[model samples]
Each structure stands twice: as C-alpha cells, then as structure tokens.
Target: MERERMVRKTEIVQVLRMKEGTGDTSFAKTAYMARQILLMTKSIREKVMKELYYCMEQPKILCIADLGCSSSVENNLMSVVYGLIDTIDKARRELGHGPQEYQIYLNDLPGNDFNTVFSSVTRFKDNLKEKMGDDFGDCFVNGVPGSFYGRLFPTNSLHFVHSSSSLYWLSQVPEGIEDNKRNIYMAKTSPPKVLKAYYDQFKKDIWMFLHCRSKEVVDGGKMVLTLLGRQNSDPCYSNRTGYMWELLATVLDNMVVEGYIEEEKLNTFNLPIYTSSPSELEFLVHSEGSFALDQVHASEISWDANDHKNRSSCDQYDFAICLRAVVESLIVSHFGEEIIDEIFKRYREIICASMAEEKNSVDYITISLTRKSRG
Candidate 1:
C-alpha cells in the first residue's frame, strides 16, 4: 500500500469496482442504513421537523445540497435519498405547508459517473411529479458534478447540507508515498513510516472536507452525515468489523503472487479506505472552525449481529456474503477477469480462518453538525 498511490489498474475485473462507502452490494446492509437513520434520530428528527414547519412559514426559500453525492446511484443511495425526500414532503404536508420551495444540489467529483445519478434522479423526479400532480411546489433537483474540497457554490447561500456515507476519504495520499514504491502500506509488522503516512493523509483529507464545507455553508445551515467507520484503529484490519473489502484485497494480492494475474495491473488503481469514529470526526470538523458540532449518534448497523446487537461475534459464513460481492466486483474491475475465481476462493479461506480465531464487530458513526452562520 503506497502512501500516495493513484488509480492506474488496467485489469477489467477490479477496475472501478472497489466498495468505497456503504456500497449497494448488500441488500440487508442498505436497508439497515435507511432504518438506522430513522432510529438514530427519531426524537431529534421529530424536533427538526417541527422547526422546519415554522421555517416553512417564512418567505425565504430553502436550499439544500448533498455533498460528494458520487455519480453512481447505488441502490442504498437512492433509497436514502428517496426516503429523506419523502420524509421532508410529509413534514411540509403535515404542517399544511404547501411546497416550501427547496433547491437540492446533488454534488460529486467531476470524474464520477454522473449518468447513473442523473438518470436515476430524473426517474425519481418523474415519480414524484406523478404523485404530486402539478403541485410540485418549489422543490427542484439538479446534479453538481465537481469535487467538494473547493467552493462549489456561493457562500451564505445554502440552508441545509447532507452527505450520507461520504467523507473519511483523503483528498490525496501524502506526497512521495507512491514514489517510494516500498509497499509500506502492507507489512507483516508495523512500519512507522507507513502508519504515519496513512494517518497524515487521513488528517489532511479531513481538513479539506471541513474547510470545503465551511466555505460553502451558510450561517445556521445544518449538515447530516452518515459514513463508514471503525471502532478502534488497527491497521491490520483484524477487527473483522465488516471489513470484507480488506479481506478481498488480501485475496487479490495472493492471486497475483500465485501467477493467477499480473501484479503490474493493480498498481495503477487505488481505493480510498476511511474509518473513523464520531468523536474523531467532531474533533476534525471543530478544528476547521466552519461547523459547530451539535449532536453525535452512533448507529449500530452491523449485518452479522444477533438480535440487532451493535456488536456481534463474527461468523465466517455470514461474513463471506458481505465481502464476496464487493471484493469480487472490485477485483474483476482492476485485475482483469482472469483471476476473479482464484481471488475469491483464496479470500474466502482467509476470512473463514480469521473468523475461527475469534469475534468481530461492525458499527458506524453518524454526526450531525450545524454549519456556522458566516460573519
């Protein structure tokens, strides 16, 4: 794992297939996020709705944006958006609030596949139109394809901001990391250089996100973010906390060494892996001075948990399902189709072995911040 690696994988199987966030591969996982959002803030959300009810009475129009809304409209993303949108409409209707005009900006990097997001949003808007029947009111939706690290909109212009399952990704790895070509990221033993590089990059990315949002958010604007995270830091990925992709990466690496695939094909491609807790996130955001931290909730979205327990002992069989689809897809895209089967087989064996050794837990941190009203 180079500190500063850029995506250059030429393999067809693994190219552009890595699971970056709460990916759509798992139906159960996706549903969990939708449900978790409701459960995590049932009371708080109710209060917000009440506030909005009064706010809707004002003559001022509302503007909201979902930053880093990557072009890929995964099933999970769509469900969350539609669910959120539906909830908002219900809030307005309950207050007898006729169409409080809202402008929603769906943002993502320019290189993202916007076709999928645009196509899906268009269809979703059509569905809404059919239901609303000429009473669409003032809600308008459009895609903003660009990076969020820079100012994408005017200051003091937004009323609300939402980024679900985004952030935690560094804008770039530390400089000169890839140049070393030492594979410092992957080592049997702890390497201080590699660890520092990874941590430093994470810190920088966090700052970029905070600074970027701080620049664009209006006074008193609210931002709700749901993203993947880890309970404790162990670069080893030993926690087995739904770290299927990491397992899959090991599988891919093994396949390459076994002569199942060419190693050179993978160096070109890189996947952004980020895991942090709610407090850690708050620290970074607060440090940026753009947003005032308000509420923080830890949602228990572990798929393998029993009785919906936030922490569940890892089981090899159940864990395999979560990791297989994601890892295999990523490998196929980056490493070519030749080693897909081998990679999967090896990955399965390793995951099972790890599970047999002991227990694992999966969890996510949701942080809600109120953007500081600009001076």
Candidate 2:
C-alpha cells in the first residue's frame, strides 16, 4: 500500500490564524509577546532605516511591507508598522530629501481578520496627518493575503520588509513524521528521523522565503526578521523551545486516555512550528546567497511576556489564553471544537505545574539582511 496519508484534509492557511475578535481569544489580546519582540529589535529596525537612507536618493515612493501583520485588539501591532513608516520618513527627510509617498502592505494568511486592520486605516491616516502635520506624505495601505513561502509581490517592488514572531511557522507540517506518535511537535523523545524531518522542512521554507523575497525586494532593500529561536548552539530537543508543546502533548495524551479524543487522531496531529538557532539562520543566509546578513541578536523572553499586572493576575490563565488564541483554530479543526475549553483547562493546569517546578522561556533571534544588487 502507498505510504499512509499523514497530511490532514484541512487547509492550513484557513485554520492557522489567531482567534478573530478583540476578546481574550483574539490575537490582539494574546500577541503581546510578539509586540515585545518588535520592541526588543528596535535597534535592528533603526539599522535597516539607515541602510535605506544610503540605498536611495530623493526617492518619491517608498514601498514597505509588514509580513504576518495580524489584526490586534487595539491595532497596536500596526502601530509597530506605523513606527517603521515614521522612522523611514524621518530618515529620508534628514537626508534632505523631499516628501515621499508611501505604499504600505500588511500581509497575512487569507483566514486572517483583514477587516479589523482595514477598519483602522482611516484612524491610522488621521493619526499620521496629525503627528506630522503638513509634512506627512500620503500613505496607501493595502492588505495582501497569502503565504510567504512563495512570491507574494512583484519583482523589485519592495524597499523594506519586516516580520516579527512569524517565520518560525513552517509552510506546512513536515512529511513522514506522523509516525512519531503522541507528540504535536519535536520533543526530547522524538526519534532522530522525526527531528530531521522538522529541520528539513524549516530549511526548505526559510530558503524559499529568502529566494522569493530576494526577487520581490529591490536591490539594496532591507528585511528584518524576528523569530522564535533557541540560544543554545544546538537545541533540537531543548526544553526552552519544545516544553510548551511537551505539556500540550501531555494534555492530549490524557485526553486520549479518557476517550476525549481518538488515539489515532492525536497521533496524526503535529504543529507546524520549528524554532531556529543563530547558526542555523546564518547558514541558510549564506546558502541562499541573495542577501547579506547584517546582524544577528538573540535574547530570552518568558512565555508570559505581557503586562500581567495590568491585563490579568492569573499567570496560568494568561499563558493559556495566549496560546489558545493562536492554536485553537488548528485544534478545533483537528480535534473538534467541543474539547477546546477542556483541553486548555488541562493545559493551564500543566503550565502551572511546570512553573511550580521551574520557570520556562524561549530565545528570540533578530536577523537583519540587505538584499544584494541583482547580478
């Protein structure tokens, strides 16, 4: 018989988005950690701006894109993009260039809530006009819905590209790893083949990403990527990156034991995430040969990288809510919606139990690159 079908019938693009709305299930509420990653990479953003200053002279239109720009509760994530626009505008003006028009693209998967982002455009423009007064150049923002694994824009159309808390997501689940039953991601117990499958998928996706972006971004354009990563030189099975999934697996296993979900279904499920190390990223950049790596910075961020004192007091609940906002769509599609609340309830208990034993967090790597001039 042909190899067993491991890939599910569900489409990833339609199911991988954060919960839609401004509530706790919404990505806006749960993606505070992503915003924190953006803040942490402020220096990288500045460096890209400086590079852009030298790349162009008296340009009239600046094309910038925020890849994986999901909708937020307060539209704060776009504020990060807005900050990018402001910095680029300021840098151009400081170089004595006249006002330049801006074409901004906010990209995410088709299932994303673009309506929310579009709803804020008027307010965003109004704020820009107010902040810069007469100096503000007209800005046109549009939503581009597609996966970044392939070309999403025309060749040589973009100047600056930014993605934060994205890219760690593989294009799709790796092939052939479904045999590693009982785990939704790479874990300490994952066999060597399973780990290799995950790494190979990441390598291909990252390379394809760089290759596609190389064609889309103009020569000398800059791209900044902040990704979930591991600081350890080689952490294929490190707890820092896989512990959350391990706990999630525990919950799933228990659910299977209690007949809450089918064992085969749980065994077939696998998350499409793979945290990278600085060395791995560097090697990919070199192998791709289209962009020059400008800088790589790594830092550790707690799972609860949000304002707990202000938003909510329960750490376990906060963590569960954040994870649920992103993974619930997948879980609900694969396991059915009825089990979501109970699954996360069990998840929270596991998180609390893990915390009681020791604190947990993961490393983030910020990589800056400049597109080399086309030969």
State which candidate has the highest TM-score. Answer: 2
Q: Name the Cα RMSD for model 2.
A: 2.6
lDDT of 2 by residue, 108-214 (tens): 89988888878888888888788876675788888999999889999899989988888999878888896789989987778889988989999999999999999
Off-target runs (Cα >4 Å) in candidate 1 are 1-60, 70-78, 90-97, 129-138, 176-188, 233-246, 261-270, 303-337, 348-361
Candidate number achieving the greatest lDDT relative to the actual structure: 2
Screening candidate 2 with a backbone cut-off below 3 angstroms (N, C-alpha, C), the clashing residue pairs are: none
- Which lDDT value does model 1 have at 88? 68
* Shift of residue 125 alpha carbon in model 1, Å: 2.4
CA deviation > 4 Å runs, candidate 2: 1-10, 73-78, 305-316
Instruction: Write down the TM-score of every candidate.
Output: 0.72, 0.93
In TM-score terms, candidate 2 sits at 0.93
lDDT of 1 by residue, 246-338 (tens): 565566566567776566654433444456756667778777777888777765554443435433343435545554533444445556676
